[model samples]
Target: MKKFGILVVVFIVCVAFLSSYANADVETEKISLNGSTSMEKMVNALKEGLEDKYPELLIEPQFTGSSAGIEAVLNGTTDIGNSSRYLKDSEKEKGLIENIVAIDAIVIVTDTQNKVNNLTTQQLIDIYTGKIRNWKEVGGEDLPIVVVGREAGSGTRSAFEEILHIEEQCQYANEVNETGPIIAKVQSIHGAIGYVSLDVIDETVKPLAIDGIQASEETIQNGQYSLQRPFVMATKDTIEKQNEEVQKLFQYIQSEDGQKIIRAVGLVPTSNKMSY
Candidate 1:
C-alpha cells in the first residue's frame, strides 16, 4: 500500500510538471508588431483574426509612428514593423524586408462646414506650401486655411510629402502626432485641412475629391486614386528566416482569409509579395 501511494504521488508530480511546461510553451508563442499609427485599424483587425485562428498565439502591437517601428524591427526589438509608406532605399540596404500587405488612401480632409469639395493636385500643393492660405481663395468661406499635418518621422507625413513632391516645404499651422488628432483638429477648426488614412474617415470631417477623383478602395485598386500609399509589414529578414510564430503571421496575412480581414478594415489587399 505504501509503495502504491508513493507511485501515485510521483505520477501526479510528473503530470503537473508536464502541464506547466505546456502552458509555458503556449504563453511564449507571441509575435510582437511595432510601428505606424496610420495602420492601427488594420493591425488591430489582423491581431484579432490571427489570435482567433490560433488561440495559443498572441500578437503584441505598438503604434509608434513608422520610423520608430522600422527602427525597432531593425534593432531586433520587434518581429514586424508596420509602415504605412514604402521602405526607403537606405532602409532596404540595411537588411529590412518590405512586405506589402495592403494599400491605403491618404484622404485630404477639411471641416464639414467648409463648402469646398474638390481640390486640384496643384491646389493641394499650394495649400501645404503656404501659397494658398485663405479658404476663400479655394472657393470656400472667408476664413483663413489652417494647414494641419503629421509630425516628423511619421510615415503618413513622409508619404504625403513624397507623393506631392513637396518634401520639407509643407507650411503646417499645426503638426499633430497621430491620425485621430489630425482628424479632430481638422474637425474642430473651421478652416483646418489635414490628411489621414482612409480607414479612419468618419462623418465629422469632409473628404475632398482630389482632382475630381474620390478616395476609395476601388479607386485605389484600379489606380485612379492619386493619394495612396502602400501599407508595409516589414521584417528584419525573409519570412522563411523568421521564427515559427512570425512565419505563421506572414502566412496568415497572405492567406485569403487574411485578405478578407484587410478588406473588412477598409484597406485594399495586395499581392503576396515581399521586397528587400
Candidate 2:
C-alpha cells in the first residue's frame, strides 16, 4: 500500500514537467540517449519512429545505469540521459531536469512454482531485509525464499529499494547486473523471487499483486497500483531549454504517436499526451 502512494508524488512532478514543456518548440534533428538498460526497450521502439519522422536525424542510445545516465548529460557525455527512476534532488540541484518518457511499475516476481502471490509493502520490506526468511512467513510453502535482485547501481534496484525504503540494506541472495538475468534466475531457480519493470515480465516468472492491486496497464493508469515509477530522460536545463532536437524527441515521447509506441512496449502512457 505504501508503494502505491509514492506514485502521487511522481504524478504531481510529471504534471509540472509537462506544463513546463507546453510552450517549447518540439523539433530537432538528432538525439543521443545514454543510461538505464531498462529504458533500452522503450528507446528501441522509439528510435525507428523518431528517425522516420526526421529522416536526417540520428538516434543513438547506450544502456548504462540511471545515475550514470543523468550524470552523463550533466557532464556533456550525452545529449539525453535515459533514467528508469526520477532524478534525485541532488541531481536536480546540479541543474538536471526530468522529462518523463513512460510509466513503469516495479513488480515483484516469483518462480511460477511458488504459489504465494500478493505481499504488503511491509511484508516486502521485511522479506528483502532478511527479517522474513521463508516463503511460509508470507503464506507460501515452507521453502527458503531466494531473493534475487539487480546490482547496486541498477536503476531498477534503486527504484525498488527507494520505493520500499529498503535501500542499502537489501539482503539479496544474488545480485545480478541486468533485468534479463534476474528474470532468468527467478524463473529457473525454485523459490526464487525478484523485481523487474512491468514491460519485461514474461511467462517465465509470475508477477504478484501488491495488496490486491495487479501491475497492469489499467491499474497503473488508474492509480490503483503503487509500484509504478517514471522512465525519465534527464538533460541539463540550459541544454534542454536551448536544444531543439532534444525538446522534439522529448515532446514526441509525450505525443499521441509516442504514447502509442510506449503502450506497445507494455507501459502506461501519461494522460497528458502532447502534440507532435
Instruction: Return the top candidate by lDDT.
Output: 1
Top TM-score prediction, candidate number:
1
Give lDDT tens digits, candidate 1, residues 1-276: 999999999999999999999887766488999999999999999899999899988899999999999999999999999999999999999999999999999999999999999999999999999999998998988889999999999999999999999999999999988999999999999999999999999999999999999998889989998999999999987888888998888788888989899899888988556642
What TM-score should be assigned to candidate 1? 0.91
**Worst-scoring 10-residue span by lDDT in model 1:** 267-276
Off by over 4 Å in 1: 1-27
User: What are the C-alpha RMSDs, in order, of all predicted structures?
Assistant: 3.6, 17.1
Cα-based RMSD of candidate 1: 3.6
Per residue, candidate 2 scores C-alpha lDDT tens digits across 165-253 of: 87899999999978889889999998998999998999989999998889999999898998889888777774347478877777677
Model 1 Cα displacement at 8 (Å)? 18
| lDDT, each prediction | 0.92, 0.85
